[model samples]
Target: MVVAEVPKLASAAEYFFKMGVEGKRFRPTVILLMASALNVNISKPAPEGVVDMFSTELRTRLQSIAEITEMIHVASLLHDDVLDDADTRRGIGSLNLVMGNKISVLAGDFLLSRACITLASLKNTEVVSLIATAVEHLVTGETMQMSSSAEQRRSMDYYLQKTYYKTASLISNSCKSIALLTGQTAEVAMLAYEYGKNLGLAFQLIDDVLDFTGTSSSLGKGSLSDIRHGIVTAPILYAMEEFPELQSVVDRGLDNPHNVDLALEYLGKSHGIQRTRELAAKHASLASAAIDSFPENNDEDVQRSRRALIELTHRVINRTK
Candidate 1:
């Protein structure tokens, strides 16, 4: 659905979408699972020839929601590559590197426009409002990260809020949308949102950890890229607690060749990596507990879906790449 919307005049857009075909599709998968789990008759047999119009309509809406979610994600990635001047993405050259910045940014806008069209087609004002807010949060989060003062970069609370805006907003809102489409109560939808919110936080925190600990090949990007880009992530935030002198280096913008290496050395020696992992684990636990709090049900499908969500939290923290 995402690729088909790319204009033929802009072939580069198709290439960009193709590159993302093999992505985990994590956001959409979560939406579909949540839809099934929340369905009241998920475990019951359908009435003969009745067509289960409610189930059919729900499936169609959920699928569109998934496509819209992926489109938004890919659009963000395109814009990010331009902002970061990234050369590679997903182990291949980034679109901006090959097609230039103008095309990449325009393609991102094109994808976003298509996503909005899909969102409108869903015909649910509340869902449209939710996703539109996610897009706004994405821009605000990226702008905040880019424009943050040196002192703000060092603060953990600022970092976490930025993380929520950038990473959690899309998934959390989409999870709520799924619940809403399924006609779930407001309380249940909030639970789904909470689960997605914590999961996204944990996911981004672990990605920050891997930036320090994982190899470039494993991570599919340059190792230590965050600090090199002058972005202070979770690991660096924790390391500042141990080595106060590093603040000056960060304040200097990490432009000096030696500064990055020196900062990495300090981070390696400090308990920053351990502390970051602990923080990620704390969020993962919150994510698990969110799903666990769902009302008890004898249905095996519901239990299995709940367990998958819990396991996904574990994967978010433990993934090597």
Candidate 2:
């Protein structure tokens, strides 16, 4: 493990921030790709006096945003692990499990603090606001998940709204930030947001499906972890729709080990997984369509990035982990 150089919390925070365990790094990739895709010279610059809007300085700032997004993502992971009492992440023991909840929580806060400092360094009020709001959405989503009644959980709308806040908000906002930094037109910025939002939703939906179909070794965590924690995800929600009796099991809570098995049985019998995958595919298509709407650019880099973004949607839907 590469230990972090944090002043006080280095030992604890290192588990996530510096541990060599790498995640997909999906958010940063999308942000950087958005930067490239929107860098076409046709759009008017947001600021005056710059011949090259996407100049070196601006590129550096975009890189910072990518780093900041990753920091926020890791911090959320740390905090979520504490909240979920999770014991594994990235195929390794979770930070909370290794360092205790107090340290893990503090480490997450530390990462957020650093991310905020970097965000402030950008000195763009609108970008700051967008990212800050994303953080708020994260908290709000987690709270909703923790406090929702069984009735609320049964509603697909409620689940999707919560999903947006928890998963899609950060990605969508960060992509918007990228476009805004490049001074892309308002329409293009919105397209970037749409791309990120749909992609994020698709990504999460696949993750939810993987929870049921993936193995512990492949998923880097135990299969069915969400249901084990009584977190009703898309598959369960769809399964409940078909097997109404499953709603009673969820209503009574999955704390009973038997209920957990019974719930899995119902899910296996229903087309929940298939429906969830279809929904994911639908969102992935929307994401691709959003990229298709971007103003056509002759720049080879822009075209390549655009194609990659569309291809990324396919990758997100088909990924097993």
- lDDT by residue (1-321, candidate 1, tens digit) is 545443642576567556663268888778777766675434344677777877766677788888898889988998999999999987899888888999889888888888999899889999999999999999999999999998899999999999999999999999999888878789988999999899999999999999988899988899888888888998888888999988887888787778888888889889999999999999999989889877777687787788888889989898999
Candidate 1, residue 34: Cα displacement in angstroms equals 1.5
Name the Cα RMSD for model 1. 2.2
- Please list the C-alpha lDDT of all candidates, in the order they appear: 0.85, 0.88
lDDT of 1: 0.85
**Off by more than 4 A, model 1:** 3-10, 40-48
lDDT of 2 by residue, 111-230 (tens): 788899899999999999999999999999999999998789899999999999999999999999999988888998899999999999999999999999999999988998888888
TM-score of 1: 0.94
